[model samples]
Target: MDKCAILPIADLYIRVSTEEQADKGFSQRYQEEVLRRHCEVNSIQVGSVIYEDFSAKTFNRPQWTKLFKSYKVNKGNRPQVLLFTKWDRFSRNTAEAYATIRSLEALGIQPVATEQPLDITVPENQMTLAFYLTIPEVENARRSLNIKQGLRRAKKEGRCTGLAPVGYINRTTETGVKYIAPIEPCASIMKTAFEQIASKTHNITQAYIHATDNGFNKSKNCFWRAIRNPLYCGKVPIHATPHECEQYVQGTHEPIVSEILFFNVQSIINKKREQLPKRSNIEYLFPLRGFLTCKKCGEVLTGSGSQGRNKKYYYYHCHSNCKSHLRTDKLHHLFVEQLKSFKLSENYYPICLKILKRTLTEEAALKTKTTYHLTKKIDELNNKIKKARDLLLQGDIDGSDYKKIKAGSEVQINILCEKLSALQNKQRQLSKDVNTGLSLFSKLRQLYEEGDIHTKRELTRLIFPEYLVSDGKCFHASPVTGAVKRLYNKEHSFTGLFSYNLSIKKELLTQSDSLIIEQENYETLGLSQQNNVSTSEVNEVMSLINTLAKIITIQLLK
Candidate 1:
């Protein structure tokens, strides 16, 4: 064990944890200087100088590992001492640090902390060594606990901590308070993307392609994650803890998309609506391929051409072992005829048109009312919580009862917030939708009859959300969508104007008067109001109608 006098060469092990690097005296340079001066004062030789910029949470530092390897591999000319500024510099993990010290001592190398010297020979000094090692470990635990609690607090405050998401960038206020601000084209692009996805007209791929065209710079996987992130909709996900399940908090940051739109996209992504993408020209024969199913067996109808003597005849038939088949032409004609019921007669057209516009206006106003009431209720609930807190502070109520009240109020507020978000989102499109729905109902027959495969499939999807069953001559869209219910409700006669039903939900035939409209804001659709209705302009507005018809069809999908 004799390294000879003046030959106890010490390997200078200077360590500074990442978080401590900016501190006044915890720098690696400071540690090196102290160790070198200690060596100079003791006439000790300096061996290899090792510097580590890592955490002392473990003995896994790169430099430490390499030195430990050298100690084990090469016995000759090895350092006699492993000198650092403190025991924590050696390791914050007490057990690993003790093991490492024993290993060094086994190799005839004494581990010395220049700042906190210990005489291993003195039995009582072992307690002092434990004290020095344990303090840093306790410090690390406390620091971690504080960080977690701070992060949880930030989430509850609806603050976006750490790096801002794709559409947002982290910013600091003039006073250095942190916040998230919407970033450029990505923010606008993302907002449009959410609306597109929510509309169900554009699938995820189409939305991605549109975004890319509009300067969306993200990979497909990244785009998927971006759309799924609730942060875009102003919801922050709180991490799960032992006492509570993971929750979503309304964020303070501005939302690129509404909560309703975000959730709608989620549902679409979750199942893609089980709706097939628009077919190509090759699939023109079966425009309703995915939307039509066998009335008998409930299987999707398959389209195929029959080989005949002179020409091939196309037909939709059950692929299963069932005898259900219909000529493509006949089914197409029947569907067109079914849509004719949607078209109002020239005599009653204006009256029905007025009714439709009035209904849309009333629906919009009802939604606005619903949104207002939900918000008001939420405020009232919050005030109740505040009052309960005051009572608890004044010793009027026990903590347990106050907690129950707070929990119940919070749940109700969450539900109301969700409903409010949906109403608000729908309201944004309601004005445009009123026009779109009127145009769509204007000529359901012509649109379906002339539309290409894409348009035809979309039209079918709206008319029949799940699938329509055709029993030879007629197509039956049971559990009818609200739009279709107006066209074919059993109780309502097409002999009259298009007042099929107003139930709005399940019954679809109730004569209940629940809502009134703000007539000033809503204009008549004028389906046949204009004596000289420009055909071209109607077509133009009709084109704008587009997939936004989904607002009317949301009942079936929502």
Candidate 2:
């Protein structure tokens, strides 16, 4: 029709790299349709189509070269435009990219994108183009780095990182991620999975697939990673590599299973990995494996099994050159008997209470006596210095003598000032000690008498700080200032382990004779002796108790 009419396009080109052409978003068919619509609107003629479906790493692209040649020789109305999906689809390298743009401009065609047009242009325009592209890239990189750092920190704190392992469920808490210990509902599934794989009913791959199909779509690599991951074990893996394994970093989260069960699973996996697997002949139960130690050498006394012709039995054997081995059951029984003697309820309370009071009172008395002496000395020095100054300033002495006396008085004043400051600090600390001592002892006693299993465990750990079994006898080192040491034999040189085994002799009761009652005890015992006691006063008293307790019990008690 018209000579200046929109020129028909020669060819429609489309390209997408593997990295780009995912999720049908950058498919060639989709791009072709969009480009064709662009062509139809512009009245561009179609000569030939060129497409690239691989990487843009090099200029040796076949489809691109074909498009260049077609534009060069075609003597008819030259194709006015070379259309692509986007700028990155053209080329990633800047040099090759510019060359292509220049070459296209030299021919009667313009290199254009279905999305952004100005991006495939001069250096200045490309720089602006890079600025736009960099936003998403930088964000992606920052997110990746953050995730990596979070994983490292979580691992050091003993948290389970990444997806929950096959045998475990992710336990979400305010304290961060922990793996749920295998119990009831989930344990059956986990046990079955392990048993099936171990017995070769299904290989690991099949097991993984089956688990995934049955709503455990964490992936095969995830399953394998879980199998190798030591987070399931209570003893956290220091590092993925054996060389770095020695540097153990404690994790903060709760363990999914016990150390023994975790080790057993790991052993099974290790056997499968090795070409020539040597199966462990015996199963040993090391009850005091983590606790007991050799006095001569600080090495732990590990438990081992003895295989006889008829039966197999377990024993605790010292790894050091000392002959220390005993039947496992006997040693466990001995531990129970020793623990029995400790009497955590009555004996522990009276002993801990006595130690607590005596130590606190001693600390307070020390503080008070020191402060009193320092104050007395300060008063004496101040009086002496005042008299000296009066004598000098009253013209009763020569200028030189006055100066000498004033200098000497200043020295005494400085010493007194320092002593006064020390006394004040001691006074403050004594006040704090009184409050802390009362609270700590009271809580310990309550925890001993009415505490749950966990609380009792904490109390036991606090009192029985050390315990050892040597030559079929148990020994414990109770705190020197503790009730156990006070009521027991004072000359007995604090037997570190065997002391816990000693009976709570009746004499220990005498130590709690002069118990110093506290101001806070009135409200703590909940003895609202007077109904007229104001609610505000009661609330204030309760508020001082414990923040955690106050949050829950505030309304109920009020």
Candidate 3:
């Protein structure tokens, strides 16, 4: 046998990151060639060539793990040497690299960095090995910091710092500068979807269907990400670090949707999120399966479809010991009837509007006071933080004490900032929310009647936050506390929990007449109402009309 054939077997481990693949020295091809030549020259037999296109930040790489497992499983035929072009190619983490090397030595396998070879027998070469391994780690950290700083600067300059959001495509200018611009059909589709959602004509599911039909074939998660991303509204979110504050910067790109419409969609998304648990799958035709509670057992009612001799039958029944069953059609009909009873009369529309306005006004005043107090508290905390820093500088306070006080102040500041942001958002959307509330309240019955199964379920859940079914009827129905519940209960004469006075009607009418520019405003808003309302003032009036329409429908049902 040849002397080289008697040499111990070795495995060549080659790795290259996507970026490093182009570098001749660090490339996989280059590393493989170097290892092969080194093995041949050193009279070492090559047993296997393992190639990996992955990061060396950790030892959990696919090829590395496979090699380790194969070695352990076939100990009799295991390679005595593991060869890589350089120490950095083996691992970027020094601690992990040293530990793994120790383990390889114990297993009778010597790991060698071909280009930067070190004999383990020499004590000085061990230190040299560590120094060589640390270079790559330091380089990685510096590269990461540079990338982060570059992104931050780009964001500050009003440039799109990451991948373009849906509805927009990234384009490079002739000057080698990149910018985001609206893409054809997709931009239009996104715009229409936003409008539909804002107008309550469609939910997220409907919007998703519309987009998919228009060639937006992405995952449901991607679709939601598009909907929730603020980048479409001309704002870029700067992610916060542990010590930094989160903020939104105006982008140079044209907005796909207005701020008002964007926020309205956000509000709708939030409301839908709250009702997600109650949402039913299309497989189950009965939307109220999990919503209803068994009156006797206090357990949740279950729903199922059964096939009879002639046809299929759907029903809701108690799951526990209590045996209670009702046909799906009968329960749904009763629920619809109960829902219609909440609609208000036409005469009561103006009255309800007046009540809602007063309630909102009082709420706005209370919020203003709360915001002011929070602002003052935040200012005081900031002052304390400044004084603490000064004391630390002067050596009046120890570093630990200053840090504790600074951390506490920062926590308080962050809380106050969050509260302030919430209050500001509420203030901005107060009018829009009131308008939506009045509009939805008026069309409650019509929406329920015309909506699909999903919408019907959502409406039912919103109207009755919690309810119990017993004796083929819904009982203990706990409606959400707001204008809808108040008007619904009052109209049905179900309860006498009145919270407003009718005396405010005259004053409210006077204020409404002055705030609205009756005919011209109506024409501008494309409304046929006779009342004189300003173009800007038509939202509240329109809301009242929507509310009236719903109430009128329900009243006719009665």
Candidate 4:
């Protein structure tokens, strides 16, 4: 007999679901071994093993793709056979399984399962094959539905589900679901990150370093993601459905950050984006920003395209009919000199301290009002209980009436008790704020002075009320306090135009003094002013200056 006539061979296909991989011993390797033995006993040759590490929901699997390709390419070859561990392992959709089997038949390939009845391929075995394939697929679908239904019910009963975000760990008990405690290394890093960002002393990179120094090795993207996530503030995201994420539910979890710090970090990120530079192919004349507004008009002195002598150059022009143009280099040098003269008085700290004290007092009064409401509710509950008892003692209340009154009083008492507990917690948090506010302001100022481009931009938005340019003048408009107005204090204005102009003069004087000092002792003053800066060096300096100017303008406004 020819070898082809004597031997029957088959391709092995195995599959497993994610849930089955965890709970069952129905492994691909084991199924392949079992099928190998079956092939040997049936005097068959093993053609190939094609398996997929995926749920057999549809025929869109890698192994299936390979199988179809091989079947099509070997159109006139010896008969091909496909073998699987079981029916559902082959496919979980009944109509799809039937259609796929019919396609294999058309390609001169046979489908067989080691666990399926051998009579399935017989003409009279239609019912048996359908039972083997269709029944298991339906069972698989039903089981999946049941699992999801159970999970939904658990969530509705207030159970926490899904992976715990970095700062939290999900805990469940007979009482209810809660975010119990923090994971040590993760939680500590999270706390430090929040404090560092809140301090404003550190940029995103510096904050990442602080976290890494404390033994956290999370990715830079993860660090930013953690900062942006509201889950750190104790909110849980519960996805809507298994098939569709249409909505979310916030679970109760222990927070790792205060609401104020979270909002402040967000503010920093927003301002950084606003200040980020956009690349332009052609150089612009208004590159020296944050200073030198149109002298005639209040509009910003901005760069516009210009053509001269068959070459292109950018000019800083007042489009608002101020009608003046200045070279980019001259404007840059002038702006730098003007920036040096601005200074804050030593009384700035005292002014900030007084403001914080008054705010803390206002917060304390609010807490006291909340406490009063809780106490009032408690008194009302007591009165209701006494009246219910009086009615019962006088035999004027029915059983239902007594039960209703008792239930209402209990509910009221529970509500008041919860409110009282919440108020007490708020009081403690407010106390911490009061104690820390003074230190916070000092830290904030230091951060503003030392912060990188991004950090400074964030701080600027926090401090400055508005940014406006008009009539070649740039000045900050700070909110005038209600108390200051009551005392008839004039609105304070900090003008960048005067500050930059004086700063340039100061730089000139400092240079002159340095030159005189150098003349006295050539050896003592080793530094020498270089006549030329390299093109690359000049470009770097210009970029740095622009970034620094933006930071300063933001800070001065604050």
Best by TM-score: 1
lDDT of each: 0.72, 0.53, 0.70, 0.58
Task: List candidate 1 stretches off by more than 4 Å.
Answer: 1-6, 196-213, 218-225, 240-249, 265-413, 420-558
Global fold similarity of model 2 (TM-score): 0.29
lDDT of 3 at 422: 72
Model 3 pairs whose backbones collide: 442-547, 442-550, 516-533, 517-532, 517-533, 517-534, 518-531, 518-532, 518-533
Report the C-alpha lDDT of model 2 over 353-446, residue by residue, as the tens digit.
3434455455546657877786777677677767777887897875566555555555445445655565466555543443344334334444
Top candidate when judged by lDDT against the true structure: 1
RMSD of 2: 23.0
Q: lDDT tens digits, residues 1-558, model 3?
A: 777767989989999987888889888778888888998798889999999988888999998899898887888888889999888899998889989988888889999888887897899887788799899999988999999989987886778977887789999989998989999778888887787677655667767765765677687788888878888888776776655555667788899987656766887888844443333332235667778887777788888767789666778888777777778878777766766666554444454554455455656678899999999999999999999999999999987777678767775576577667777777776565544544555566666675545566666655555664656755455555443443454553212122234565444444532133234424423344444333434444445444444443322221
lDDT by residue (1-558, candidate 1, tens digit) is 555555678999887877787997988777778888999899899988998889889887898888889888999978888888888888889899889888888999999998899988789999999999999999999999999999899989999888887889999899988999899988999998887677665767777866875788789889998998889988888866756656788898999887767876787889944884673423655777887888889999988778789556778999899878889888888888877766533332333334444555666778888888988999999999999999999999987778778877885687678878777777776555544455555577866665545567777776665788888777665564543443334443223223333343223222234434324211223345344445554343333232424333342123
Output the better candidate (1/4) by lDDT.
1
Worst 10 residues of 4 by lDDT: 513-522
Q: List the candidates' TM-scores in order.
A: 0.57, 0.29, 0.54, 0.45
Error of 2 at 232 (Å): 2.3
- Better candidate by TM-score, 1 or 2: 1
